[model samples]
Target: MPNEIPSRQELIDRAAELVPLLQKNALWGEENRRLHEENLDALTESGLLNLRVPTRYGGYESDMRTVVDVIAELGRGDGSTAWVMSVFAISTWMAGLFPDEVQDEIFAKPGVRVSGILSPTATAVPAEGGVLLNGKWSFNSGVLHSSWNTNAAVLLTPEGPQPVMVAIPVADLEIVDDWHTAGLRASGSVTTVARDLFVPEARVLPMGPVLQGQHRSQANADSPVFRAPFMATACATISAPAVGLARAAKESFFERLPGRKITYTTYENQAEAPVTHLQVAEAVTRIDEAEFHARRAAGLVDANAAAGKPWTLEERARVRLDLGSVCRRAKEAVDILNDASGGSSVFTTVPIQRIERDVQTLNLHAILHPNTNFELYGRVACGLEPNTLYV
Candidate 1:
């Protein structure tokens, strides 16, 4: 049977429905240290994996708002699932940045899934009709199920080592199971190693031009989603998941309030306590703030893309600032919820504890780190160019 492509709302609703199932399998995924097969099956069946594929290839060709909404919904279920989906969707969107021939072959695969890391951690030495890739890349989310992987490497050229983006089949690389971490453990973000592997020249996309809004694909030039500033949209995509995770934490904290008693206190119901009231108000407000910043960032990026405008320095800096704020505020909200949930919340069996850890991990990410982005934004606000290559 052919897969039915869903409307954006339908896909978002489907993701919401999967929350309970994802919660049920969350422990299994954590224990196994990879995305649960059941969760992956459900995601694939729902057509969520095709959210960013071109419409001509039976995909939804979803926009940034839909991407944020769907991933955020999934984050409420399992952070790992949501994280993997965010990476997959972003990488799939990048396929449209490649030349028509590359996009044609990549999207041709049935139920195509792509995963990637944009950091140029590998080296590509020039070779006949291609380049020889020899290095390793880490934090490759969703590597386990990907059909193709987009990697960034410094190309050995006469001028200098020009960093470029290349898409290669998963069958051509080696997967190293080194993703053991404190949070987002189920994401299976293992390392990929390629030694002396030949990647065809046609598969490479120049990173410099793409970052500057110069694209090689005439086929997708008219697509708003394809024309957006790459790094800004990418950061926004990952930032949305943290908002959903924080919301889950808030909901879990409140749901247990009705029957709970203040520990070693005279209060019979925690819900009636003034402290509980204040904590709930504070956490909920923080979550709202986080969601506001995330949505704002997504809106700005999408609007620019729709208008076919290049991002000014301030616009790019603000997106990073907004993303960092989202992660910071989300983590802070989860922390408050954790404290409010009492001692039991720290147990391994408790979902809130896991959510807390995942949000902390999310904040620790270099891309989402509050301090780093703040500094970068500060630099740009001071009328200086930010040193980061991503913008």
Candidate 2:
């Protein structure tokens, strides 16, 4: 069957229908740690997974805000699926940032998909047209659904030193199937390996310099699609699901409040108690704060792109910090909400337990790690040196 291009609303609507099934299967996805074929087909057919590709290659090319909204909505149902889709969709956009010839080769087929685990853990040897890549990439979310992947490789040429993005055909790469985790377990994030794979010159892109808004791809000269710093803003995609899971936690906590019994208390319903009010309000308030900033970062980045200027390093760091902060706040809020449930929310059938673990798990992402991002932002702001060039 052919993949169909869907409007932004259609994707949201489709996600609306699928979320419930996902919610029912949330634990199943977590236990399996991989997306089910049924859900993959639905997303692919609806085109929810194709937002970032260029219009010429059959993508929606919608702004980042729309993408955030859709992914957030999906997150409210299942954290794993949302995380995978967000990364996959963003990688599609990142592909546009590659050279035009690279784009032509990768997206030559309609509705083709791309997924990556952007750890930059590969080696690139200078070859005739491009570089021969060899190394392993881990945490490749949506690995099962993608036809191609963007693997980060350090450019090692006799001429000089450089960092590069190497496009690898999914068929040529090997999956290590080693993803085992407590949170976002459904992401089935496996490791991919490539050894001495031949890549054309245009297929390899410089990492450090191009991320600052210069690239060999002249096709992007006429379009602002590739003008934005999709790398620094990367955490936004991962963070959106945390916000959504927090929202779900808030909702689930409230739905049970009216009829919940308090351990040994005379009152059978906890909603009437003052402690319930305090915890619920705190959870709701924090989740609201998370929502605002998550949207704020995406809106600001998209607004800048629409304005024709590229995203700055500070702004990029801000996205990283803000995203990490939001994820942390969301998890904290949910923790409070979980406490409000006494002991019932801890059961296997309750689902809150899954969400709680998922939120905590998302906190471990390198880009979304609060302490690391805060220190990076703090250093950059105070005129100290940053640890990594990417974020």
Candidate 3:
């Protein structure tokens, strides 16, 4: 339970009660390829909607592991719900690192949800008191239910070019509605367009020093809350959903095993076969192993943050390693389960196919891109500069 560790367990307990409903509701998400309003309400009532909100704003301010467990539970039933909640809710915390003005503007109201697209696809021109921003953000997850959106933008001045993430109110922009994808379709990861929107000085935070451990939030000044880098924690949130989906696949396979027969074999019940035992064991093992790795990484993160020490590059890179490995393990577990599930595993009635498709789509995310993170960790281990700032 979430409360058993760094977060309150009551929240997760409440969330668990909704699992069957969410499992039933998952199809609506897959059927329409978009998160339905009912799914939104279910999550909101489950306390997941506010899991990442700062305690100062009537939220749990939960630890990463608690968040992980909660998400894993949701993901076990529906990867789409889990993935959307992971990205959207974690970004809610990311919004807290901004200046108080921006933070107040975004979270001051009730029922407000924030969505972010970090791709640097915009240009900001300096104005008297603020910057004039114009750009389009791709993969704006949770845009449909969000009241605010943050986008990464580049600042071009006569002096030079610099990068900054600008938090923009969704009211200031237009939705492009282009979120066609194979997996995580319910994310509603549409594109947002902003043209010549004049942003106030208080609304924008400079990029460089803040990421290197400097922050502007008065509440964050001495608090380690803002000190934790998003990159290191980001994957833990993303990968938990994968672990949950794999768990779902395993359960679905077992549930259908007794009713189905092996195509080429004389087995009437797959569960009674020795090979079924072997494959099921392998899948369950892989899923458990992934959870262990994720827990290790998440524990280190909370420990260091609680102690007020900024995680060193070594530690951060290690977290990246843990993240990539967990994703691979989760996928492996699902593949094993699907294989054991036989040809019928892909039927529209079988949840294995959905879990399989979900894992495949989730694996390709830029944040979880296996080869890239692995190489970054390798270079770091051998004493090389990080391949990118994300590490």
Candidate 4:
């Protein structure tokens, strides 16, 4: 790692350079149901893992635009890798929102990795110094390789049930190897069980304030990169993988197009067929649209952070809209390309099948689902109160 922060373009270039390595490890990652060790080492060496860490901790503290760009480049290589990295970026940013002392503890390690999920599936009770937390959080992506987890849980306060984010070491939780899935298999998003785990008060952050851009970290308060709303930043960062996956499908399709023929048809060259032309055109268009939405969403976050502007309800809803649009468009692109891929594309050796599955999985995510996000945006646009606090 360099003593000085790298420029946005430099970080993006580093990510692009890791594409072949991530691609090479994709199959192995899928087979073993976790990111390859070599992939982890490569990410650490690239300093990409520290993208969202505070500058005082030797991290770049890059803006949201740079974050999405780097993640998209990683997505072009492997969707699982991209997804895991995206989660890390979001989680690390969340870590920065904690009290300064907590940040010091978490960011002190070299090449620290933190995995997290927003769903408050656990419960926390008052304890001596902090809270005694216990519950199970599923879909904890990258947990196996992570040193910490910023999990959400419901706190049993005297006032009632309060949602809170608790930072806990990975060793304190019991790992369950249950990440069997048709898509994003390499993410290692398994279930983690926390049984009577004691978390210090410094490690527990109230979610309500954090969601509204009122973070507790005095040290990071003035930092532009940490000024944006949490959900907006998260939505922007997570949307990048969809765009990259679409591009991956396009790459896979065009790479194999020259030698491929329309089987059982008169067309000797698939690329010459009018239907192929239409499919290619449609897929390319959707991919471009996906990129457009991704960039717009990231731009919104970056601009707001730099200006220190408070996010309007409509703007927040629109960020969610952008996320959904990216997922929907990217999936559409991958579907068009996958449909055109034919039977040979089903082989494990082919990249399109994996890209298709990955995009499909992303679209199905609760937060990333196209229909849910569209409905939320539409509701907010119609002058109704947002149904969820997540936005």
Highest lDDT model number: 4
User: After superposing candidate 2, which stretches have Cα over 4 Å from the reference?
Assistant: 1-11, 310-312
lDDT of each: 0.89, 0.79, 0.78, 0.94
What is the model-wide C-alpha lDDT for candidate 4?
Answer: 0.94
What are the per-residue Cα lDDT tens digits for candidate 2 across 170-197? 9999889898887788888898888888
Per-model root-mean-square deviation over C-alphas:
1.7, 2.6, 2.7, 1.1
Q: lDDT tens string, model 3, 1-391?
A: 3332234577667667776876787777777767878778888766677777765676666777787888888887788888888877667877777887678778897557788876679999999999999888888888777887767788998979887877788888988978777778777788888899998877776767655656567865655555667766676777788878888888887788777888878987777889888888888899888898788877876787788777788888888888787788889998888888777666767788888888888778787766777888999999999978776
Colliding pairs, model 1: none
Show model 4 residue runs off by greater than 4 Å: 1-3
Per-residue lDDT for 144-217 in model 4, tens only? 99999999999998999999999999999999999999999999999999999999999999999888888899
Better of 2 and 3 by TM-score: 3
- Could you tell me which 10 consecutive residues in candidate 2 have the lowest summed lDDT? 1-10
Worst 10-residue lDDT window for candidate 1 reads 1-10
Model 4: pairs clashing at backbone N, Cα or C within 3 Å? none
Clash totals for all models, in order? 0, 3, 3, 0
For each candidate in turn, the TM-score is 0.97, 0.93, 0.94, 0.99
Against the correct fold, how does model 1 do in TM-score?
0.97
Local error of candidate 2 at 212, Å?
A: 0.8
Candidates 2 and 4 compared by TM-score, better number: 4
